[model samples]
Target: MAVAATKEPNRLILFTDAVVAIAVTLLVLPLVDVVPEVAREHRPATEVITGHQPEIWTFLLSFAVIIRLWLSHHKAFQHVRAYSTPLVLCNSAWLLAIVVLPFPTEMVGVFDNSRFTTGLYIGTVFVATGLQAAMYLIIRIDPEVASEDTPLPGEFVLGAVTAAVLLLLALVVALTVPGVGYWALLLLLLSGPVEWAWRRRHAVAAA
Candidate 1:
């Protein structure tokens, strides 16, 4: 049996990290500066924020979704010790999705409950999650690119499955109840606790 050769591409991971960082940074762009007269003339601070509920939702949802993707990206790349051209290209597509996120956030800020806005937001998340899944497959396919400390096969599968489930849940909520789809953002925010508890139980059982 012949072992697959590993070729280290130095810039791919660094480029990927930079793109992810920028994506996360842009998530907060929906926050706008409040004019002094607007605050003093219209209503109190709480009411002013309430007037900007859509923008607030946009910021919160985009922030949560970006963070979720970034964490998964961090996890995936942490195990990967090297990269190939195709993997780099796929990752670029993934980052392209990241770049797109703010547009949907803008849509949400303007037309939060509109079907079009909800659909666009859900679609972006679905595509991003799918891309992340593809990255997982690329790493799994070329074992030589990953380090010995890479996540085990079962753990990898579990992480991928969880991401898919989260994406699907977001989509379902958008389709069935667009009004509640924004709350699905909260679902992703709460996922860390749920996964942690599940892992703790499994660890105890294994022990």
Candidate 2:
């Protein structure tokens, strides 16, 4: 029986970075459009920024979110030296979610906070985080994908899963609770402590 060939991951990593750059760039386009609308309305020049506070805020928020996600993706692939079909598919799906995020981000800025908008925005984030978690898990288990000299850390694998779970929890809070809205995303901060505890527990076990 013939074995499937593995390919170097450099091109895949470069492609992922390019897609992430485009997605991050797309997040700011709506804010740029606001400038023309303000001019047409004959409002004070400052209103271009001051009047569109919601849009500005959401753009900043999404920018931070996309950057953070990209950082996580970079971390996940840092130790990878090879790739397979499943890894490619997983990464593509993650990129698709990243591309879709700007739509919900715009919706959040334009529409009043509602279950639908909040759910949609948080849900897109959740999907992206979940896909990243899957990538970490795949890399951890697949000997063909990661480098033998520098193994992927167990904390990274658990941290990705922990972050995804927090995002899911945040999505649930945003959907079910009125007035909570995007504040629900604060749940994601728990990931650091959770991952720390996991590391401590494992260190004790190893000791």
The most accurate candidate by TM-score is 2
lDDT of 2 by residue, 8-76 (tens): 888998999999999999999998898889889889999987888898888899899889989878887
TM-score of 1: 0.74
lDDT value, residue 180 of candidate 1:
77
- TM-score (all chains, Cα) for each model: 0.74, 0.94
Q: Poorest 10 consecutive residues of model 1 by lDDT?
A: 1-10
> Model 1 Cα RMSD, Å?
4.8
Over the stretch 1-207, how does candidate 1's per-residue lDDT look in tens digits? 212235564577678778877877777655645445456686677754777777786688678778878877777777777777667777889889988998888888877577777878878887887788778887777766666775435465456656667777877777787367566655565556666777889999999
Residue 44 of model 2, lDDT score:
94
Q: Which candidate is the best by lDDT?
A: 2
Q: How much lDDT does each candidate structure score?
A: 0.72, 0.88
RMSD per model, one decimal: 4.8, 1.6
Model 2 residue-pair collision total: 0
**How well does model 1 score by local distance difference test?**
0.72
Shift in Å, residue 37, candidate 2: 0.5
> Stretches of candidate 2 above 4 Å error?
1-5, 205-207
